[model samples]
Target: MLEQKGNLFILSGPSGVGKGTVLDALLKDYNDICYSISTTTREPRKGEVDGEDYFFASEDEFKSLVKKDEFLEWAKVHNNYYGTPKKYVDKTLEAGQDVILEIDIQGAKQVRDKFDGGIFIFLAPPSLKELESRINKRGTETKDAIATRLENANKELEEKKNYDYLVVNDQVEDAIKKIEAIIIAERCRL
Candidate 1:
């Protein structure tokens, strides 16, 4: 049998859609796959490790990276800048370990443009009302921030047709199975 070449998988969705939760469950069992840790200009939240959760950098240092064009995709969100460092992702792929990126909708679009052949998955809520409910349930954001996320969620939903797959996150296990199946099917394609 031939050795399999790795493929990049981009997971994108609006806030409060449970994207992280689903990925967390999947990662628990699939530890061998590489997950791209993004770089961020924002300060680490409570209990967030600088290098593990994200490559925490000062705005100046992030700007230097931007100037050098070192990011596969970067964007400013909620007054903080975030970007996917190119080197780690490239190295992971070269090592034949598939790389998974959990990014925002815009960042996903940017990666899709550059990596047109990569697998693009868009996760969606069961309904707009349910999404609002989920955001409100989190209790992590201010009123204004929640509003901003809902607005962005609407916009993100508009781009769902652009992705290679759409998985509605109504149930956690079913969504995971769907995503796992998609990954398995994609691996067979190449």
Candidate 2:
């Protein structure tokens, strides 16, 4: 009788804020939400698959896609490119499947302008000190890289006001619970 339309929910924050961990737990619990995959020009990390974790692309290929207007939102971050594909997100939403994008603040801004009524959620760390410790524990970054990330984290934190919701990721389970609540509340909204 009625056509169903999906709402777009964007989860974004600074690097090392545990966005992936929180999203993984949330996805495990929610069966209806679709996680939109991002395309990136960066090299894949260990254990990352080509199409699962990210659609890894070369700089040239990424630029080609950009030229073709294939991305809903794209941004250059940390010396590499990342983008959300327009077609996939549009198709899934049109099919009445809720789509979630875990992205950075820059890309989130781009999506905000394009996707009206999108629920923007910003994930934050408990503190800068704790965020640095989390990054250090990863051991994936050089000292210089860690420093740069911390610097960028400050700038990203300033943009939290742009989001409709803010979740501090002190614990992964707690973060997932809060996000789940948001999803439920939004779904119930008239």
The lDDT per prediction is 0.87, 0.91
- Candidate 1 at residue 30, lDDT? 67
> After superposing candidate 1, which stretches have Cα over 4 Å from the reference?
43-51, 140-148
Off by over 4 Å in 2: 40-61, 76-81
lDDT of 2 by residue, 20-125 (tens): 8899889999878999988999989999998788999999999999999899799888899989988888999899888999888888888988778899999999
**Each candidate's root-mean-square deviation in Å?**
2.4, 2.8
* TM-score against native, each model: 0.86, 0.85
Q: What is the lDDT of residue 131 in candidate 2?
A: 97
lDDT per residue for candidate 1 within 160-187, as digits (tens), equals: 8888899999998988889888887888
Which candidate tops lDDT? 2
Error of 1 at 61 (Å): 2.2
lDDT over C-alpha atoms for residue 90 of model 2: 92
